[model samples]
Target: MKYSLFTELKSREVIDLFRSVFSESEGEAEGQVISDFVSSLLATTKPQDLIGCIAEENERVVGCVFFSRFTVPSGQAAFILSPVAVSTEVQGSGIGKELIGYGLDHLRSQDVNLAFTYGDPTYYSKMGFKQISENIVNAPFPLSQPIGWLAQSLDGQEIQAMAGPTQCVDALNDPGLW
Candidate 1:
């Protein structure tokens, strides 16, 4: 049977479980930036903005995702989707999809309209995303992903004017990530 729950970042053991799952993600980068991003986000956001997923089988977390607030030029409300990972052994089990879907539903509940990420739309679009050109600035990643830049608007309204060079959010002001 499949099970999932939404929760906060939580303590060390959960973080460790998340890291193990992340090490298997497609862009697997030694999970160095992911750890830093988690720390930086924890320091930068309110207790409410950081969301995670605990996917379970026999009550053990085997997957997770991180969604936190980011200040777009509008300074209204937006979500930054980073670090979604499933256990290396459970890649085809759909855990990653459930995690992302939960995050999206939570954002919907909060009336959040936008979600941004630098990843393939093929995977993300399945979670209700599409390529967006309104990227005002580059992502904090070292590698450029012009085509990989995408956004998913929860309200069903397209964001044609949302493009611009992005500046780092105070919550994400880690100079290294940028």
Candidate 2:
């Protein structure tokens, strides 16, 4: 397996991978929702505001994840991970974890201070994320699954409580996604 920036692969390829993976896991209607969300993320977000990584095998994208610019009231550099997808055929191969690690490393190198993700805590905890309270750092929207609100400090410092609402890129600003 090879890992690289999401931009390294064709946009359609990444979109299709998400569609396929989500369709298998979450049914077709949800798959289309995620596909459209990814399309908006790619088309609407500024390059600097979006960071992505992909796992490829035999030159075909098999997994993908994205981190979009997140604005915190504290003014620290932050991004949120969302819409991760790994091909159904290779779900147990650890490709998703490695791809997320690659993206987080890229974020660290770029001096990103805080990384947040809304997902399964059990899975993301394996990636070093811990459940964060809204009282500590609020999410952009009211979470449907409050337990899934997770965060990690990329730097050595601990996460400090930030007040006020957070902001995500337009593509991720939708409440339905939260």
Candidate 3:
């Protein structure tokens, strides 16, 4: 598998991959929701704030993930990972993990100070994310699954408590998404 940053030309493929992957895993309705979310993310977010990553095999995109700029009161460079998808056929393989690692490496090189993601703690923990409380760093919206609020400091320093609410990009600002 090869990993690389995605360009606008691959937008449709990336969106389709997420839709199909989520449909298989979470049913059709939820799939459509994720697809729409990705569409909004691609269309509305500024280029500098959105980073798309893809895993390709035989020139076909098999897995994809996105990390968008997130804001914290402390003013450090931060990003939030969301809507990760790996093809159902290749779920057991390490493609998802490697793709995420590639994205994080790219972020680190770009001087991103911290990374946050809302998802299954068991799976995200494997990626070095630890559960963090809202008091430490607030999420943009009230989380239905507080346990899944996870984050990691990309720099060597530990995460410090931020003073106010965290803000995600417009596409992810929906309360229902949390």
Candidate 4:
């Protein structure tokens, strides 16, 4: 498998990968929701504020992940990982984790101080994320699953409490997505 940064040329393929994977694991409606969300993210977000990564094999996109610029009141450089997908056939092969790790490495090299994500704790814990409360750093929207709010300090320092609300890119600003 090959890991690389996402390019606009692969936009359709990446979106389809997310749609198909989510549709299988969740449902068709959920898949369409994710597909629309990714489409908006790719179209509306500024290049500097979005970073995407993909895993490919035999010239097909097998796994994909996206990290968009996240804003905190404290002005720390941060990003949020969301809506990750691994092709059903490759789910257990670590492609998702590897794609995420690759994205995080790129963020670190770019001087990002923190990384946040909302997902299953058991799964994200393997990638060094720890459950965090909104008191420490609020999510852009009120979370239906507060326990899924997770973060990791990329600079090896403890995550400090940031006062006021957090903001995600326009595409992720939907309340339903939380």
Candidate 5:
């Protein structure tokens, strides 16, 4: 098991990694969906979002996690993690935990304080993510993975309040995403 910076990810192999690891639920995705979901995931986005960190094993990407910058109602900045995936072949191996730990540490170093994601409470809860109703900042979609929408605070305390919609600013242009 190895952790790689998401920005270092490239090549056809990485795309294969995304597709293979995410295959289980692709059936629920629209027919127009493409694998380029990874293209714009970076800190370089207009609002400075975080890209995904991946876990590679035996020369293959087995796990993936990505974060995006967003504004809460109080105008404070936060990071929203989304679309984490680990291939069935590598499930229950602590790879996801390592990825989250890496991301949280990375965010902390950069002074990013808050994170939002929709995922399994049982799984993400262990990583400090909780279901906070008032501070919810969501993706463009209706949060298909209800159980996955979770939040965590790392470099700060209590999430800022929100009033308007929580969006990724430019996530709509990505062909790889839903």
Candidate 6:
């Protein structure tokens, strides 16, 4: 398997991968929602504000994840991971973890201060994320699953308490998605 930057692949191909993966696991309707969300993220986010990675085998995309600029009250450079997908056939093969690790490393290299992601705690915990309280860093929207709001410092420092509300890219600002 090969890991590469999202910019190196076609947007349509990645979108289709998400649609197929999500459709198989989360049903067709959810697949479309995530597919459209990814489409918006790719089209609306500025190149510098977005970081994405993909996993490929034999030149075919098998997994993908995106991290878009996340605004925190502390004014530190940050990004949020969302809407990750791996082809159904490749699920549980560690491609998702590897893809995320690659993206996080890339963010660290670029001097990004923090990384946030909203997802299953057990799943993300394996990647070094810890449960973060809203009191420390408020999520942009009221989280439906607050326990899933997680973060980690890329520079090996503790995540300090941040005041005020957080902001995500417009594509990820929808309440329905929270």
- Model 4 C-alpha lDDT per residue in residues 1-178, reported as the tens digit of each score: 8999999999999999989999999999999999999999999999999999999999999999999999999898999998799999979988888889999999999999999999999999999999999999999888999999999999999999988988999999999889
Better of 2 and 6 by lDDT: 2
TM-scores, each model vs. reference = 0.78, 0.98, 0.99, 0.98, 0.75, 0.98
The reply for model 6, stretches above 4 Å from the true place, is none
How much does candidate 4 score in TM-score? 0.98
Question: Residue 98 error for model 4, in Å?
Answer: 0.9
Candidate 2 residue lDDT tens string, 58-136: 9998999999999999999999998899999999889988999999999999999999999999999999999999999
- Candidate 3 local lDDT, 57-161, one digit each (tens): 999999999999999999999999997999999997999899999999999999999999999999999988999999999999999999999999999999999
Model 5 lDDT, residue 101, Cα:
86
Q: What is the lDDT of residue 162 in candidate 3?
A: 79
List, residue by residue over 1-178, the lDDT tens digit for candidate 6: 8998898356999999999998999899999999999999998988988888999898888999999999999999999999799999889989889999999999999999999999999999999899999999999998999999999999988899978888899899899999
Whose TM-score is higher: candidate 1's or candidate 2's? Answer: 2
Name the regions of candidate 1 deviating beyond 4 angstroms.
1-9, 24-29, 135-143, 163-171, 175-178
In model 2, which residue pairs have backbone atoms overlapping below 3 Å?
none
Q: Which candidate, 1 or 4, has the higher TM-score?
A: 4
Name the 10 consecutive residues with the lowest summed lDDT in model 5. Answer: 27-36
Q: In model 5, where do residues sit more than 4 Å from their true spots? A: 8-11, 25-36, 39-47, 134-148, 172-178
User: What is the TM-score of candidate 2?
Assistant: 0.98
TM-score of 5: 0.75
Better of 1 and 3 by lDDT: 3
